[model samples]
Target: MPPANGAWAWLAPGNSWGWSNAGLISDGEESLLVDTLYDLELTDEMLAKMRDAEPLANNIDTLVNTHANGDHCHGNELVCGAEIIASSASAAEMAELPPEAMAAIVAMAPDMGEMGRYFLDCFGQFKFEGITFTPPTKTFEGELHLQVGDKPVELIEVGPAHTRGDILVHSPKDRVVYTGDILFIEGTPIIWEGPVNNWTEACRRIEAMDVDHIVPGHGPITDKHGVAAVRQYLEFVHEQARQRYDAGMSAFDAAKDIELAEYSAWSDPERIAVNVDSLYREFRGEQAASDVFELFARMAALAGYDVATP
Candidate 1:
């Protein structure tokens, strides 16, 4: 359901692993897309829906990718000629993953071959096959004041949280924020880049905004309270993991013992392993950097019930 203002359209994919919700901001003459869908087919669907609403072929003048994740920017090539914008860190992260790597992942499972079948099962049908990468032309580090029609949309950077350079889009006129991946409503929050405190602070900033409705990067369109829920969830996980880390418990060991009593309702509780791992690493050493695969495998092991194998 799109917001009542008709200024932004919310596209909810209605899946656990797919990049759940995307928003489109309209400007009457020309519009701006907040984030593209996860894959080409999904992107095409989103474009079609938007076109139906406005009946304008080229209303989308610019595409602003909130982060570097494939779910938000992979369908860039399908937009014809919309100028893409993102943070410099997001652009850097985008460059790190090749289109071929994504294609290889897409080629697996439910689609065609067997190599990606397992991944497809685990992550759902998130295939970015044959999607061309379009780099961001405008990269800004801090806050950006964008004019979407008469309203001023604030592109605030809250990085080292969800990704290298995470962003939350704020609409001052409507008192609504299109929080890109920063707040995952009713789902497990993935922390590709995090210090825990950064996320907590990001929540604090949103709380201060006192916005009416927050369009999360994934999941449903919720109010300010929903954003608070994710923040509290992160805070609870951080403290729980920190306590076990202080006791000299390993990541896998801590993963089992930690009870997510507050966030038991959200999807993918297994993600607690990764959240604990990231917090444990940060608690161990803020400046310490571990291999991404090592962290992923450890989280996977925890998710696979190896933690309770003992």
Candidate 2:
């Protein structure tokens, strides 16, 4: 059975990633949506499904942007008159990234711009339009409890790891936790902002939770084991990156040098660069903000092309 609380999850696949999905949730009265997909068409389908599941989007009172990633919140503008909510950190990070940037990135195709086109085609599959920039109607620190009709949900802050404002949504009564990007179930876990250890710890915390159902920000619905696998990946990558960084290896060299043979089967093998980049910054302390561009460049090397930038 799908999640109750009037929620619906659609598995959106193909394009760049082999598997990617989006979700919707409602609470009878005012619905709360989590992680809208890339564009209006996809988002419209998700909304229609949500309405089919429960009549909420027609009058959604609140919306939450788990984090600022495009796949998660690109279709936000479609939720007309809905009060948007995200951690201050998430809002800030998202504001810095305009949908135009993504549109621009995806504008390229193979050949003169093969890599850029690949990224654009993959990440660009989700249509983004009419998405006006609306900051969160409400922001909170630590934890926030919300009532969507009678459903009680917890908005948790577990970031400075995935992104500055990464959050997980927990519904204790429902025994479900929507782990934004904290857990990527069967997909490549990337750390745009990380202390890899913090991410490792977040996984531990997830594992320790009373909840049994987990909805990863990406990939299919999963369980604690799925959570554990992601945790293990981060731990392994952290150790691996640290080894190369200590040897004074550049982030690119580390991406190439580290084989990750143990995780050879993992999807998006290129994300090793993201893990390396995040770990490198952690190793550098306050003086560093990982160069996301450089990391993307290295990632593209391993991935065969740059799919995120145009």
Candidate 3:
């Protein structure tokens, strides 16, 4: 959906995994892209469509990755000659799990039991092989302001929440915000890195913004109402998980026991496992990151699938 005044949001249909949304902000011959697709083929397809819709897309001057997530930035190699920019934390985190590692994990899935099946179910659609992992060429910590022709764009860092570094690409002039994974809309948000409070605070910041169009990292384009729903979910989960933590319940047990109510209807409800675990770690003041495979195994268990210990 193209918002008024040269702002366009490329939304991928369905709230399922790996189908992320991207955006293009153009004025005159200058353009800035917000994130990319999951793989080369998907990115290529998106770029083609974008070019057809807006001529400025033919030569993107800048590319801003909202976070370190593979779905948001994995197809970066396709945007040749564009100066890639991201938060310093995001850039550092990008190297932690490259395309080769992801491809290798998916390849081993057949013999790995239920967790393997679950992993494949989420990411098997994308081709991760042969992708040259592209890191950001320009990195910043606090905030960076740029001009896309005459439109003023602001990159606001709000992270250590979704990931080590997450950002919102806000076009103040056009009243549109490209929220990385911070706003999941119809999909349940998975907190891979969080204090819960930080994520909630990020939501509040978005709600307080004057923006009219909210372009989420996943799901359809939305508005402040969508922002409120996401914030409500975060607060609900945080309170629920805190109670379970105080009761000495294991994160996995708490994830299965808690009632999601309305949020259960959201796509990928199994993500609550990771969210609860992250909250528990926060409560304990633990700074160490959990093992990704172990977390997936826990999520698989919560989803009623047999999980083999990794």
Candidate 4:
């Protein structure tokens, strides 16, 4: 659903794993797209809807990827002739896990045991095959200001939190902010990258903005109240994880032991496994990246699936 004014939001149905939201900000013949969908088919459908609702969408002049996540950018190939944009960190991260890698993972799912089944459960619906990874043609750091005809659009970099380079698309004229994966309204946010403080600060920054509609990367369209909820979740998780870390608990055990309280209702509680692992690494001052497979295996365990015999 779209806000009463300003930009229009295109949300995918449920608040599950790969279902993300996109946006369109248009002024006369010029238009800017917030993000794309999970795959070619999904993106094409979104584009068709946008074109029907706003004629300017047929000629989208700018395509701004809020982050490097595959769900937010895998459909870039459908938006032809648009100047694709992303943060420099996001562009680099995009290369780290391309479409081919995802396809390969899906193919190998059958033999990988419980973690494989969990991966399929999260992403099996999306068609990742034959996706030509379309990287951003233009990249920036900090902030970049652009325009959609007469409307002023601001791209604010608030990352090294969710990912290496996450961004928020603020359209001042329209009073809307398209937060990439920064605000996963009502969904449990996983920390692929974190200082935890940075993510909380990003939430505060959004609250301070003069915007009415807040378009999240996943889940429903919301406002500052929704932003506050996500912030509260982050703060709560950080505090809980910190306490467990101080007690010399392993990250996996800490995730299991920590009470979610009110946030237990959120989708994908298994994500707490990843969040605790990240916090534990932070506490240890470990700069090494966690293995993606290992993280998924932990999440699978948390989800009550038996780990494959080694």
How many residue pairs clash in each candidate at the backbone level?
A: 3, 6, 0, 0
RMSD of each: 3.1, 3.0, 1.0, 1.3
- Stretches off by above 4 angstroms in model 1 are 106-118, 286-310
* lDDT of model number 1: 0.74
- Please identify model 4 stretches exceeding 4 Å from their true place: 4-6, 308-310
Q: Against the hidden reference, what TM-scores do the models get?
A: 0.89, 0.89, 0.98, 0.98
Q: Which stretches in model 2 have alpha-carbon errors above 4 Å?
A: 14-20, 108-112, 286-291, 305-310
Report every candidate's CA lDDT.
Answer: 0.74, 0.73, 0.92, 0.91
Clashing pairs in 3: none
Cα RMSD of predicted structure 3: 1.0
lDDT of 1 by residue, 1-310 (tens): 5574645655565635666567776655666788887788888888887788765435577788888887788878877777788888999989988566766645543453332343455555666667777889789998888887776778899887988898888877777788788888888897777977888788888889957777888888887788788888888888788788889998767987887775767776777767877787677676555565455445445455232122
Clashing pairs in 2: 39-127, 105-310, 106-120, 108-117, 110-114, 119-307
Candidate that beats the other on lDDT, 1 or 4, i.e. the better one: 4
Compose the digit string of candidate 3's lDDT tens values, residues 1-310.
6976799999897768899999999997799999998899999999999999999899999999999999999999999999999999999999999999999999999888888899999889899999999999999998999999999999999998899899999999899999999999899998989877888899999999998899998898888889889999999999999999999998888998999998989998999989998999999999998988899998787777887543
Q: Summing lDDT over every window of 10 consecutive residues in candidate 1, give the lowest-scoring window.
A: 301-310
Give candidate 1's total backbone clashes.
3
Q: On residues 169-246, what C-alpha lDDT tens digit does candidate 4 reach at each position?
A: 999878899998999988999899987889999999999999888889889988899999999999999999999999
Q: What does candidate 2 score on TM? A: 0.89
